[model samples]
Target: MQFNVHIGAGAVLASALAAVGVWHAYSSGWLTPAKPRAGLAINERPPEFIPTNGGVLTIAWVKAYETFEKRSPSELELKVPLGTVKVPLPFGETVSEVRTAAKYQYQVRLQKRWPIQCGDTQCVVRTGPVELAEPVAIYHGETERKTRSGWARFDKAANLEQLNRSLGLALVVRGNEPRNRDVGMREGRVEIEKFVREWMAKEAHGARRIVVLYPGEQMVDGRPVPAH
Candidate 1:
């Protein structure tokens, strides 16, 4: 018996092989995927985009200060280091301005003789609310820049007033750290997670997405979709 092979059979086989080769190239990173098209579906006027405000949260390293005791005129004062603190921000609030609120350390030094009732004869010296240098911007993201100073004057139009009353989210200051890798820093993170978990439990606001913004690489529980 003579078998008849169609001429298109060879062409079909070649087409199948070409498709497989293209797929292999894609799998092997030799081929890059096309970028998604931006804009509205169908005939659109101005693109109407609703801001979901998916709870944009930011954590920032605030100010650090030192305390010391000035003894006599000849005696030098010993300074004690105060670790850096993380100041929280109001939820859904975009900071329009950042200004520092002054907090000062005062020391009373002995000037003239006092009565026996006063244990230490000292002049009650009133010092300044000495302003510290502005904190250097660490995480340079859009939200990070706005929230850098920790204390922010949120935009009035952000509708924070309504959100604040509904959300009941307040900026909380946790532990103090001398540096990012400080032992207290880890402890602070733990505490922050605990706080977040507790806060989540209290919310009956249905399912919501939590997006954490960090400076460097982080180990997430599952495979994370890269934002970049």
Candidate 2:
């Protein structure tokens, strides 16, 4: 016995069309390209965490000269917003406020540290770096700040002015994405929060992280919480 197998012209044409569509999509980066994904987690038996000494931290945002150059954040930068600031004494020991700027370079005034009596001749009152609760978003331009009519800045300024002596926090700006800056700030804030949570989990310090996001302008734990 002999058997014959045949395929319909319609079926062959449909397959060919599907194959071409896929090829076109792949070449156009619709199917072939993959977006970069970020993952966050705590490590087991992580190294000892050291806090940056000082009651104040200065944040500066500079434009990137080369797009290809990798960003090398300092130890303070990596461990911040999650790391504690080593403050001394009962006088102005708490963090008062956190600030950020889009200017190329700027200086911040931190509280003066206690006097360290060196030898017998002179006593030195030195100020060190302040621990950051979160990494500041330094956009290439003031696109977000300007577009929002400095709404984010206004929030920060208000929060800092009414800041309490107990808790310190970095504001996470979220809400509508009318532009690119809005989206950038939102994503950056998410990453910063993730980094802090990961550190709290991995570091062996046995510390708990508490985050409160307010929908509007409201105070939580003595700090102003901004919402979307």
Candidate 3:
């Protein structure tokens, strides 16, 4: 077709072409993946793509925090010593009786070891079966005796908030979330499985695609995709 076009039509065509180019740039993984919170980098890899709200104390805690139990094959998850668990100290309302029990020492252990590059060749590796993460103990926090009713009321208000927090998700395009840095895999394929699992767990009434947008651009699995 060799039809001559007017200047107005030419302008519209140019604009349309530009828009198409932009759309492709967005989808071809041209844009960088979001950066996760800092200090959370495992084995020097920054994995910011995790969208979960870190359901640490939620139903998924069993899953999210279960790395300690599983045998990881990389430095993505650290086998750290001295992980803390809050233990409620029970005592009387008055301070006299509680003072006697405060002096005793309590021990807790945290363990999880992952694989890593050992040397020049594939020689770098864990020698035998997965080694256990180190265990260490620290003094528990100061004991306080609030009434069972007092704690019940506080937990009623606080625990319910935790229930809702599990439903929330975060798109950390920049910065760090050092607390869970260990969850990110270096050069590892994106955690699409986690995303899909979480989406399925929700009650979606109806939706064709679970699209996410970055900086006003629609994203397909965090990579920009064509919107229409």
lDDT of 1 by residue, 66-151 (tens): 21111111122234345675453333323232222212111112113211110121111111121222222222122211121112
- Going through the candidates in order, what is the number of backbone clashes in each? 0, 3, 10
lDDT of every predicted structure (CA atoms): 0.31, 0.33, 0.28
Q: After superposition, how far is residue 80 of candidate 1 from its true place, in Å?
A: 42
**Higher-TM-score candidate of 2 and 3:** 2
TM-score of 2: 0.19
Q: Kindly list the per-residue Cα lDDT of model 2 for residues 1-228, writing each as its tens digit.
A: 998989999999999999999999999878965544421112222223323353433333232211111111122212224346743222111122322232222122343332221222211122232122233334444322111112112233333344421111222121111332334333443443454345445644344432322124333343434433
Backbone clashes in model 2, listed as residue pairs: 81-132, 81-133, 81-134
Q: Order of candidates by TM-score, top first?
A: 1, 2, 3
**Which regions in candidate 3 have their CA more than 4 angstroms from the true location?**
1-63, 66-176, 187-228
Runs with alpha carbons beyond 4 Å of true place in candidate 2? 1-178, 205-228
Q: Write the per-residue lDDT of candidate 3 for residues 1-228, one digit (tens) a residue.
A: 799956798899999999998888879979656786531233443211223343221111100211111111221222334558544443212111111011111111211331222221111111121111112111234422221223212233343343333222221211013332222221011232234335444633223233222122333443444345
Clashing pairs in 3: 26-224, 27-224, 36-48, 37-176, 37-177, 38-176, 38-177, 40-181, 79-112, 118-124
Error of 2 at 130 (Å): 18
